[model samples]
Target: MIKKLLELSNLETTISLRQKELLELEEKIEEKKRLLKQLSRKVRKYEEYNVAEKEAAVTVAVEAEPDSEKKVGEIARTDLVRLLESGRVPQSVIESLKDKRYSKDTFDLNFPMLREVTDMGKVDELKKDQ
Candidate 1:
């Protein structure tokens, strides 16, 4: 019957649309998982350099590897990035850097900053689930 054929056509079309949507949702879930992993790594890095408040006034010993060549009195920008991300750096310290705020006395070191750059141009279409 023509009525029966129409019903079959409509049902197939609806199923195809839903299948496409399911694929898109799956892709988003995967993307979110990747982002979570990146954030967790950042958090772990933050925790590594984090200091407890009670230990604030305490002086800690510094031990550099005999073969290491890192400077004793300087941190690179990436190191600065860690400090900034740690959230424990006093606002005063951040403020004091003002003159060095992109200001001179500002010895340039590569600091890590928390920034996520999403390029929208590379988005891909999710293929429909079979």
Candidate 2:
């Protein structure tokens, strides 16, 4: 009985020491995380300051120009440049447009009728077979 009691006491002591060490390790881990967060905050602050400095230097050298160079319909230039950038121009219409010698009126659209349809027909045919 005495030998068993002595073994249990030794085991209890070892367990208590291990638990104390584990608690100390957890506290150290939390402290390290706090230090890391502080360091990251400092790094972010310096990055923001560096960016602000560069922006200040760049803005000093930059000058504003008149915007009269841009056309009223900027999307036309965007779309045309996008199409040209893709390098897939293979249509006869585009080739004819590239000819550049045609009269300006050749591109004019002819329209005399304007109609708007808003009705959705039911599940029955409205027109008979011809």
Collision count of model 1: 10
Q: Which ten residues in a row have the lowest lDDT in candidate 2?
A: 108-117
Model 2 / residue 21 / CA error / Å: 0.5
Error of 1 at 5 (Å): 1.2
- Going through the candidates in order, what is the number of backbone clashes in each? 10, 0
Stretches of candidate 1 off by over 4 Å are: 51-130
Task: Score candidate 2 by lDDT.
Answer: 0.53
TM-scores, all models, native as reference? 0.42, 0.48
Q: What local distance difference test score does each model get?
A: 0.52, 0.53
What lDDT does candidate 2 reach at residue 122? 28
Q: In candidate 1, where is summed lDDT lowest over 10 consecutive residues?
A: 57-66
lDDT of 1 by residue, 1-130 (tens): 9999999999999999999999999999999999999999999877654534213411211121324565634443444555566776555344544433332333342331122226645333211111
